[model samples]
Target: MGAPVIGAALELLRSPRATAALTTTGAGLVAIAFTLQQVIGWPGYLAALIVLTLLLVASLIARRDEIDWHWAILPISLLAYLGWAGLSLLWSEYQRVTLISFSYLVLVTFVGVFIGLSRDTIQVIRSFGDVLRAVLLVSLVLEVLSGIIFDAPLAVLNIHGELAEGGPISGLVSTRNQLGLLAAIAVVTFAIEWRTRSVTRYVAIPSLALAAGTIAFTRSPVVGMVTVVLLLAGAALYGIRRLPEERRQFAQYAILAALALFAVLAWVFRAPIIALFNATGELEFRLKLWQRVLDFVPVHWLEGWGWIGIWNSASPPYSGLTPTGGRPHDSALNAVVDLWLQVGAVGVFLFLAVVGLAFVRSWLLAGRRRSVVHTWPALVLVALITVSVAESSILTEFGWLLFVICAVKASAELSWRSALSPRPERPEPLPHE
Candidate 1:
């Protein structure tokens, strides 16, 4: 490019609105890749992601000195996970899959780090909200065309909803559950944006409504459950925040104590709890899948079968998985169990630490007096944790990307170098004023 062209590009990036637009566009593309992979097709989604990452990288380099470089770095846990995944290729029974998975991890890491480092917490939320807005809007329009006008599914977007026909609308996303997750995040993000008055009422209200509609129409037990849990958790946080400082300190410990007690109680009554749920036949089928996995875990207890979601037939436990389907045992029906089964105990610790640290930092930030914007991180962590226990979404596309973004944002917030790039100082008011 010529000097004038280069100068024009640099000039364009100097405007905050321009920068935000670019950032939000990048975010939308990533959201599409992570949640609507089947719709755009994986290869297309991957291509868009790579291009976005490169553009973000260029922008980062252009404003290198303006950013707090130390806080701009990747999280240690992410580095550890990447390193472990890369190294797993050595002993991995399925070399090809591991290599490809490692590459995908690299792409996701690049995108996550870019978003986290380039923007502040509020901007991160705004950009992410913009992505969800674009997604939900496009998906809704397409669904209307398909389900209502044409009386057929949106084949290109892979949207099949129960709204007009039977179940929840998949929309641009792959499944009803994923759609519900997107909608759930949209609700949280739009609600926070509204509370802060950061976004206009017109945009925020409709987005929130659309998201809520998904929860209702999808009839996804998980999404409904998430909504309830989030509501109660938010209420609890608000109640705790209103408490006196000394009382709040004691309350925190009490909550922890309560959790510890509950753990023990649940363990003691585990058999009955299992039996109680088994009457519904939900736990029975899931447990059978888990049993199939746990049965062969001893084969690679320490090293694990390597860090790929898909297992090759040659791999021991995967080979032993019955019914002759490659999709067998993809999820242990639990994120922790899935992580352990894929990369062993060490991987679980590293991944969980990443999430735990993020949650802790976010919770602390949200605890500040009248810090409404800070709630974004905490609310997101709530969704991530709620999904982690019941599904392996945290290990998959949007879930993984969202988790990484939260972790990176949390790490940035608590970083020691926050003073390095302090906001531009405001001028003092006139003495008469």
Candidate 2:
């Protein structure tokens, strides 16, 4: 059965239509896997991983030319720093966590490659949209059913704190923050697709609404959602300006309509939002954690205590020894804190450098006055990079998938550029004809 499915995938990949559909579904499976984690356990994760591996193999087989050098380069440099830090045993606990971080990102890189191979940026985005849509749809339906089954108007779930018996479920499969991060990405995807008249976006609309509602229910998604919406609106404005005059007016109308709809939904659901705000508890907890990280950094100033070493001790006040206690919730901040806690200032610098370099390179590529190939995908990748900051998305299947999509998409853009560029004239053949 697996072999036949694999054969069919290869065959479909040969055609643009099938390829487009497959790409969309494939990219989306990442989110689906994550969302269902609550229901599926290890087996689901294994299935997802297997699918990811197949996609990676297919991406390699579908190679138009050589793989992009940058894709390999960025991961390698980052990996080297991680390896060096790991071997040195800088911060014991930090080293342990770094291994998991490394593994997570490796997966994300593989997924990114598949995405990079997509025919266009729209295909990549749509594929991702499909994945998030699927995850959210399933979750929303279940949440509704759960509300009905349990005989409660307001079901509640605990998030990152002590559980209150018989609380709202928050519709989060597992972690409260993850649902928020996923919803944030969904909002961006929905906004983009709704404007373009994609039918799936319409189907996914309720899911997006439910996701926002769930966020309000959980109360952890505000910062991420706010950031994503602001970015989406800005991107929409940029996109509208790029369209032709006749289409530009329509695009503007669509954007305004979508924004209004979102506003109305938020207003209608204001109670849930207010509840979320209340549920979020004190900032003092995170602030206390951040202060500990800051203090740890000056003490370990150089190479760091090593990953394993971090777990061995705590940063004075907050009791940092436990990974579960006062953990850095923000991914970017986590990286910095992790580095300081384990490897030191140098490690933090290198990690940031790698991330910054990748973005800078992608930005430069996007700015070039090339045709459809490089320009749009670069823009989309920049958006993904922006999303990665707050969300620990770098370690998820979604992250891997995005990386693969961008890699192939970027390379394909360059290829299309060369193919479409005007060639020198062939003089004599015309006269002879």
Candidate 3:
């Protein structure tokens, strides 16, 4: 009886519908984390995450035989970073907070690993599209109710109900910039869905329009810059996909060189560029905050203060770093700076390795794969990385979840282990539009 019951449970976990349901739920929760925290508070939010993580772990164990163990090495940098974070507990200024925060990070990472290992790239994209569509639709409806219908702010959710005034609205997320980032990612997912014909035109078109509307209303300069970068990246991938295999390698190198030169030129003309984005005020605020963070970094320059993923208001250094009226700042507003403050220089190097390798692998896969779906991960990474320069979103919650999924997926395909062993057979390519 026990054996039969256990077998049934395992069978249920292996079902495709079960995988999709879990993926969508996980993505939705992470994406609207701030909303969840505000609505249900920390206890409820943590409960939901814990439940989701347990279920995903069960699913992963049930399908353990299906995963290629060699691919474990593919996420070596990520593992190293996490390991270093865990070790920081020994030296953590606030050991209790570090333990709690690090646990939250692990829970989110497990969900990402499960999705990456279980779903194909197209399936992952579909799951994200479905979740984002629902989130954005609900956000818009709430904005309407608050701005036009009730004409009052939703104080609990931090939504100012400014949609009626052509928002700098926060929506259901924490800030206008966050909403804009999610909307930008939604745009990429919706476009890929349309190109792949994964969804009908009726669905895809409306989804794209909704995402675009959200981005326009948010009025976030950081997101605006990210959107431009995403467009350029999409165009570059589109062009590279058309090149012959032999010339593609050369083209890739040439493009990299051009991008490096462009980065230097952009830095040289950063004053005008800052004005162009209308982000002069935003840049000034970040520069001041970053300077404060840097000043404190030398105290623990090598190992950092500790691995508290999100800032704790009661903590010593984080509490006093920046003044925001009564509100506590959660991040340094720069991912690299955040890393330097939390995990120090070594953590920063490991993190760069993780993102750098993930982007290169996904970018190459985008160029070589025939199906349009392959481009999704690369474009999404472009958005995430660009936004990271101005926001530390990638270090926690939704941003971290998406980064892990992309990095794991890319590593599964392009890991060096593939060359050492027989390359695992992949699913048939979707028909190119």
lDDT of 1 by residue, 1-433 (tens): 6999987876666566666876787666656663546656678877877777777776776777777765564667777876876887887778778887778777776766766766666677778887888788877777777778787765555566345764567776655666787888889899878876778899888889988877676666667667877887687678767888768766655654664596599679978977874654545666777777776566666766787764455555566664474323446667877767778777778777777667776676566435566677788888878866556777766677777778787766664345666654323222111
- lDDT value for model 2: 0.51
**Residue-level lDDT tens digits of model 3 in 1-433:** 9999989988898787888899999999998999999989999999999998888888888878876665644488789989999998989899999999999999999889888888788899999999999888988999999999999999988888889999987777778888899999999999988888889999999999999999999988888899999999989988898998888978877886887799899889988876766544888777778999899999998998999977887897988875758434688999999999999998899899999889888888888777888888888899999999899999999999999999998988887767877656666457432
Candidate closer to the true structure by lDDT (higher is better), 1 or 3: 3
Q: On residues 214-260, what C-alpha lDDT tens digit does candidate 2 reach at each position?
A: 55654553345444555664566567667766676566556557756
Write down the RMSD of candidate 3 (Cα, Å). 2.0
Model 3 TM-score on a 0 to 1 scale: 0.95
Q: Which prediction has the highest lDDT against the true structure?
A: 3
Index of the highest-TM-score prediction: 3
What is the full ranking by TM-score, best candidate first? 3, 1, 2
Off by over 4 Å in 3: 1-3, 68-74, 278-280, 322-328, 431-433
Cα error of candidate 2 at position 70, Å: 10
Give the whole-model CA lDDT for all candidates, comma-separated.
0.70, 0.51, 0.87
